[model samples]
Target: MKWWLIIILSLSIAFLGCEKTDKPTINEDGTKDNGKLESGGKNPKSKTGVWLTDWNDAMKTADVLNRPVFVDFTGSDWCIWCQKLEEEVFGKGEFLEYAKKNLVLLKVDFPRDIEQSEELQKFNEQKMKEYEIEGFPTIVLVNSKGEEIARTGYRPGGAKEYVKHLQELLQPKE
Candidate 1:
């Protein structure tokens, strides 16, 4: 019985000692170790959207994946709500993880207060016209074929709720 108990304990410890699939590590300096951030490290993988400088590049990438594109339109430098979304939503570990999994993130930023590359500015304007964005921080969900599926702005919620919201967006509209 003692031998059996030892075996079980060993197995338990081994399993527990394994690193989580993708949980960010806490660094000794009180910072999260983003570790070769897959998507700019600004947004976690669970949260699928990412900031993109060029819509054409995004479209090409999305085409290859055959996944729907979820775009986050924000004024990264000049908008208070955009800042809040970054801090309260994307900054949260849970939300970032959820985003990385479900959808293909694409960010279209128009920062009026900051100097943006002329090429990037042109791309943002083109996508804004293409998507007909009316406000800051518009989260637009599109189908695999580039068809618009749904749209929303940031709202109060946790990671689970955000996951549910994204899943609902992916569902077929009646």
Candidate 2:
């Protein structure tokens, strides 16, 4: 009886330790939660992920709210670090909530190993030159008049820390 109890307890501990954590559900199309945006992104239920594919579009989005612009330069595919940041940070719920309320998002994608439209490629390259972007997953925060406020990289603290960082960027320069 004692031996059986010890075996059962050991098995239980091992199983618990080895269990995989439940990530937010990835949908059939490889997006999360029916394409819902989580973690410092637009709401999935609302009209979100309205990417400013071009500088003109970015200007337009920036003009509307007159809010500071948050630009994300990423290689959506074939960038392992970008993927890690996306899964660990941007995929969280609280980040999405803060982003939806605070600022405008602009995504500039530079895909290396995949086919893309000429226009998109041109746009990305153009922006890369314009901003002098040197790496993948670089984030730039700019104000309404198109002045750069801050430049950042992927951080591991997820939504809450991002919000704090963004707030600091939004603060008036002392």
Candidate 3:
């Protein structure tokens, strides 16, 4: 009976340890399918409609568009607050619209369970070191020239408030 109980407990633990990870579908044009962003619900494509994982590609696009790059440094598979930010803010249409017009969205994920290519892993680690990321859900805003403009994290008050906060951050300091 004790053996059976232990087996059951082990199985439960194994199941609990398993986590679901969403892998973004890469398009032919090197952009990721925006529908897979772990955004809690079905995520509609932004008006600008592209999310790049590669830093060089995103920076080039930012330069071309004359827009800032909004980098989301997230532990997508493990962090609860990262998930909350995705669900409450990024998934909302308001933030998507604002991001579409003003920002080049780049997702730099540090997932524990999901597999990433070695090159990508190295790149992510290098960027994390460069930016001195200390926690999950660090949102770094960079200018078109690839200079860091601001850094932020998960905030309350949902999409509108988050957008307002980003707008404030993007404002030129006096």
Candidate 4:
């Protein structure tokens, strides 16, 4: 009886130690979220060239700059392809420079373990349905009026090649 009790207690302790933790995911962009109802970004236009998390802000900036909005819908934490897109293209200096000049960048992240506010959550959900996003790493280009111009996903090659592809997509159709 004593041996059985000891085994059970030891197993319980091990199981409790193995339980997952609810720690905040520190993003590459320097924002943190604990995985419920806090906004996912620093603020509206926190950094001039950084990606905006709010759609309205993105559109407003795009209109002011006369630039197209580059909306990246991604599962930032869990999606392999999304991470690849970030590493290969979005994180590169060349893309960042081009984006600052000609694009209002927006990041709509659906993280598996990050917290966002209720309003932000609703807004993201609405846009997800509105844009008919069917997968992770969906890159949608839209005009200042929020009309979708073109949509793309992960493409092979690095930042230069991806930038060239984006330039082609952003070209005005005759």
Candidate 5:
């Protein structure tokens, strides 16, 4: 009888310890219910559009819109360079506008501070392995067919320069 009680208590503690403390509830519209913007509450709604957290949904949107997928591999709560990129480029108006018209944005986050759902965590891990991502702030461009076109990381300068760099990388070779 004592052993049974001990086992139950141990199981309860293990389950409680594994539970997430800060998991954000994602709405059906892909917005977070925690009153925070997808990119750590930097921008609300922009002309560019919202950054999607789901890979399959982003791919479907890209297929329908005929736009390429821009996947941002970020560590939103931990990586300094990721935060810098988010502030300098992704959070800027110019880049938002460019993204709205040209790209389908997807954010795959591996955060040390934020608690993500188990599904999101697993998916991000799978993508990291698939893309061979070695660092935070890795940006991968994929065509509608889900083929990788280009890859880049944190760059100096603001939104406009980053936009131009993306444009150049996306341009077809002669």
Candidate 6:
């Protein structure tokens, strides 16, 4: 009886630890530490519609293209909202075309299942600290020098509306 209860409790705790499948949790410092991210490296001109996970590479691409960097800080594998945003906005043709023309896309992710290189994990953790990331799916727009110009998160809308929202955010405020 007592042994059975203890065993069940332990199993529950084990299952609940790390990357909550039912709910999203943030650390005391407001950083997301769940899910996983995969690398998607490709040439900007290829127009294959993917993101670069390397920070330095993204900056270089932005410089070469004279464009801002769209940095997506996400828990790509576990964050439900992140997945929805990708499906409803990022993966669509409207945003893809807009992004291809105007931005160098970068993905910095905190994942659970996948094994990120130690260097990559360190670099990404440092970036989270530098950016003061609050939660999964935080998006920051930056210039070629990698200075942030604007920030936003998951918003309700499809790709076309999302493009409009981005256009508004990109507009110069006088």
TM-score of each: 0.64, 0.66, 0.72, 0.72, 0.72, 0.73
Q: Relative to the unseen true structure, what is the Cα RMSD of model 5? A: 12.3
Tens digits of per-residue lDDT, candidate 6, 94-174, equal: 999888778888999898887899999999999999999989899999997878899998999799999999999999989
Point out where model 1 deviates above 4 Å: 1-50
lDDT of 2 by residue, 11-100 (tens): 999999789764566644355653323334432323233445555545555655466677888998988888877777677776666666
Local distance difference test values of all predictions, in order: 0.70, 0.71, 0.85, 0.84, 0.85, 0.82
lDDT of 4 by residue, 1-174 (tens): 999999999999999978989786764457664543333433333334688897877877676557889999999999999999999999999899888667889999898888889888888889999999999999999998989999999998989999999999988899
- Candidate 6 has what TM-score? 0.73
Model 5 ranges with Cα > 4 A deviation: 1-48
What lDDT tens digits, residue by residue, belong to model 1 across residues 11-122?
9989997747767677544557566344443423322355555565555556544566778899988888878777777777676666544557777888877888898888
> Ten consecutive residues with minimal summed lDDT in candidate 3?
38-47
lDDT of 4: 0.84
Tell how far residue 136 is off in model 3, in angstroms: 0.7
User: How far in Å is the alpha carbon of 169 misplaced in model 1?
Assistant: 1.5
